[model samples]
Target chain A: EADIYQTPRYLVIGTGKKITLECSQTMGHDKMYWYQQDPGMELHLIHYSYGVNSTEKGDLSSESTVSRIRTEHFPLTLESARPSHTSQYLCASSGTRSSNYGYTFGSGTRLTVV
Target chain B: AQTVTQSQPEMSVQEAETVTLSCTYDTSESDYYLFWYKQPPSRQMILVIRQEAYKQQNATENRFSVNFQKAAKSFSLKISDSQLGDAAMYFCALRQGAQKLVFGQGTRLTINP
Candidate 1:
């Protein structure tokens, strides 16, 4: 069983449509991250949150936006989806600095824009 | 800034044999952690092993072990008696204190029957 869950395991939308990718963790981790990965490639961090109401853009620049209203929930939204937005989005959560479990990742969401 | 690098894009090993995947990272921080994660076709990222930067002893788990050289900034994963199930895309990640995790370009491992 997965402690972290991402809804809409797969999504396809028309260009210019707005979509929200939902990620929730049951572990109550203080750190949550959203990573964008292309097929057969590396993961690029697009957004991250240290705690509630604290979100920051990652090393990779993305048009998407994220929010951390609660400790367990971090959702990424694209105001206008485009063909370039097609890729897999992975959600991960981790404990505090002292915790050594690393990051627990969700199965990931495959997004396609037509 | 932190960066992880996996030199090999793909590696193949015969069943029951051993294979090693190489990873190197660049980081200025002394207090950090390293991890190896495996992602199968299902796309679920599974934690394979972890190593703390301060630990001198290498970390091992069952058929998997990591050669963590803090001085060299290299962390390699060695899989003993490789099984068909072991075939997957393996990623090397690094995380500094209270910082986001950095991932390398994954290496696809193939287990030959």
Candidate 2:
């Protein structure tokens, strides 16, 4: 089973409120990623990190920011939530070895900005 | 940059039967990787199978197998003995080396019992 975890399985917050989505892994993966998806829609990459202190923006432009201070934790923060930001956020992690290249994804957080 | 495409928006098959889901990708890099992931109603991305670009042998995982045509740039998933548990949104993903994964729109698979 995948060891990655994401907190706040579901969230509902008011507009303009700041929110943070937490993601962690116990498998000691060096690469982590965040993807946003509408219900039953395509998943768009938002943010990714190579390792601690390394972060990069993905194909999709996201207002949220992510930090990887530790190898296990990669948290995404939204400065001001909006109704448009309401979507499911998925976190995934992969190891450095070729044998472990496939991603192990988290259950994902469903956010609703009202 | 690489792009993954799933032409079928949705597909269905009867239980105990077989079905195929089409996936095609475009990439300039010679060395890359292709993957198929299944997302159930719970919305967790599950890696079903993976195929390396350099490998000529198709990757297979029990009931799940892939038809990888490198020259055609097509990677299709074939599920033998379709099960209800297989009903989900299937995504085709591409990754080159250590870069981030790129996913296709996804195909929703349904199993009729």
Candidate 3:
């Protein structure tokens, strides 16, 4: 089945540790996005990519970085994790054709920095 | 930048009852798209329904329907015959052209037995 996937559904790491959250999609969509969400709060777009070798920062200021080397992969990395970095990270993708279908989101990764 | 607003932070409905979740948005563009997403405790975002800006008809999916007032920029979701499975966090989102989705603060819907 064609769908988006996110690895390490839950993570716990010490402060200052480097971590990466993996996200991949089989839908063959060109646009991918990463969002950070806190409990009972709205989602904040951290990063997005139009296609391979294309990436941009979203409205929210994020310390994390993302790369889109392949059409299917869009991974997010935190060079130095902190307690405040704990949050649920969601991955989503959409085609360029229409916004009517909306973005297909992955299950998401819940990271807790100790 | 387009912004989505969910005025109700939380709402509840008894089983088999109906409830409406309110949502409003701000945008300068005329053409766009609106969506309602459900996020359960499992934390997966699921698309409930969508409406096109140019369409006069409101969007509906089974027991789920939307009341869209384009002129007022208000989009509300109504759930009829609410079930326990309907308990989840609902988010209103907006998208214009090829831009990324802007999500609302979300309304936590609780289905009381």
**CA lDDT, every model vs. true structure:** 0.93, 0.93, 0.94
Model 1 TM-score? 0.95
**lDDT tens string, model 3, A2-109?**
999999999999999999999999988999999999876689888999999999998789999999999999999999999999999999999876456899999999
Q: How far off is residue A33 in model 3, in Å?
A: 0.5
lDDT of 2 by residue, B16-98 (tens): 99999999999999999999999998777889999999999999999999999999999999999999999999999999988
Cand. 3 Cα-lDDT = 0.94
State fnat for each of the candidate structures.
Answer: 0.69, 0.69, 0.81
Whose lDDT is greatest here? 3
Residue-level lDDT tens digits of model 1 in B4-43? 9999999999999999999999999999999999998867
Please give the distance, in angstroms, between residue A6's alpha carbon in candidate 3 and its true position after superposition. 0.2
Query: Model 3 over residues B50-111: C-alpha lDDT tens digits?
Result: 99999999999999999999999999999999999999999999998788888999999999
Clashing pairs in 2: none
* 10 residues in a row with least lDDT, candidate 2 chain A: A95-104
